[model samples]
Target: MDWKTITQIDRRYLYIILFIFVSIPLLSPLNLPILVGEHAQAMYDTTETLSAGDIVVCSFDFGPATIPENRPQAKGFLFQARELGLRVVATAFWASGGPLGEDILRDVYGSDFPAIPEYGTDVVYLGYIPGNEVGMQTFGDDTWTAKGTDHYGTPMADIPLMQDTRAAEDLSLWCEITSGTPGEQQVIQFVQGRHGGPAALPLVVGSTAVSVPGMMPFYAAGQIVGILNGLSGAGEYESLLAGAYGYPTELLAPLDAQSVAHVIVILFIIAGNISYVLTRSSGGKEK
Candidate 1:
């Protein structure tokens, strides 16, 4: 192929190549080895530390726009939580987050994973609570006050899991799968703040790539025990589950596609640079 042609390749051709690179891995997932980051590993370790019957609060503090990145983290957390036999109290601050949390529970703990805890008994969805930080504080003060009813509108007093666990103070761990504001910040300000630190409530945050940088400070400060940063973090968590706990890996197809796409992008970048260099050298020689 001519150097000029390589340098001036049509955008459509690039799109087609990218599509193939992304689609193939998704259609047929490869069990590519992923290096679990410190954050993901920490999250895994925290989940493992929970004893059966211990209550852990899981907050879906994001919207549908971040589902692609946040969903895998949610699945990873739920899988680990269930495997460890911990009681999960699911809730959301964002309006759309409630349904998204429900979807994660259904997909992760539903028919696919038959041995998970029963809803309302071992796992309960408290749905969305308004008032952002204020609502988080209310949950800290009294869980039932912030979310008096489960997602299904059943009173918290009716659910076995919710009967004794009244607030963030009663829980062993606090996990947040978030994308933007009203997520880690609110959890830190209200949940962690109420308890004094991670030692008190053990906060774990799973955030999108864009939000990870801002959250690293908390991770470093020990305010949050663990974190899952974006899709790569999700992939790392998946690797941990499959390798350590023998969990299924079929749901990790998107991560495989992401890895392949990154490689394809790097290759294209190198090729374009080489083509540009050759094109410039040829022009210099002609001059």
Candidate 2:
């Protein structure tokens, strides 16, 4: 086929072809070695250091669009957190984050654990509060004021776990998974700095790839205790979760699929570059 004709195919069609080609590797098995990175190691180390009965705040600030990237991190974190017997205090910084947080709990702890830790006892969810940074600041100062109730509309004071809880300092660490504004900033300025000097409370964050640049400053300055970025981060966290609980290998097939797809995309990019160079050298347009 002529170069012009070949290129005439809609770009979306190429994407579809790539999608299906990638799916094949996913459906089949490709055992890629899992490389542990410094970031994931930091996250693991932070969580592992938790003392028994220490409380953890899992703050999900992500929306539905980013669920693919952040949800897995939550799953990995929650699975490991439960194994460690740490009490969890979950919250959603955005209205959209509420449902996603519940889904994460249901997907990970619902069926597998089945016991679904009683709300406000083993875990508690403070649903959406709309003031953005202001809300976080208020919650950091007083959770009950900012969010008067739990996800189920029960009063915060009535929840067993929150009976003694008032602010971020009460928790051992706050693990934030978000994909938008007012996430890292809110936690850092409010919870991490509630007492005016870095809050002494440890902080962990999970963010989309696009947020890495903005978040690096916090990580570098020690404002954030740890970070989990993108799917690679999820895979690393998953690896840790898998090891700790001896979770079935079958459940991790999606991570394998994702890793394989990334490698294939890289190869495709290299091949495409090479083809363009050769065609230009031969005085022809790229096909």
User: For candidate 1, lDDT tens digit of each residue in 1-287?
Assistant: 77555866778999999999899978888867678789889999988988999999888988989998898888889889988889888889988898888888888778642235588777888889999989988998888888778877788778888887887778899899999878988888877887656787888888898889988788888988888989988888888999988877654688889888889999999888777788777773311
User: What tens digits encode model 2's per-residue C-alpha lDDT throughout 1-287?
Assistant: 33334434567866886787667756876677778788887888899999877888888898889887898888788877878888888888788998888888887667532245455677777767778888888887887898788878888767888886787667788888989877887788876776554446778888897887788888888888778887778777777667877754432456677766777778767656666666677788754
> Candidate 2: where are CA atoms >4 Å away?
1-10, 111-118, 196-199, 249-252, 275-287
Clashes of 1: 0
- Clashing pairs for model 1 are none
User: What overall lDDT goes with each candidate model?
Assistant: 0.84, 0.77
Predicted structure with the largest lDDT when compared to the true one:
1
- Tell me how far the alpha carbon of residue 62 in candidate 1 is from the true structure, in angstroms, after superposition: 2.4
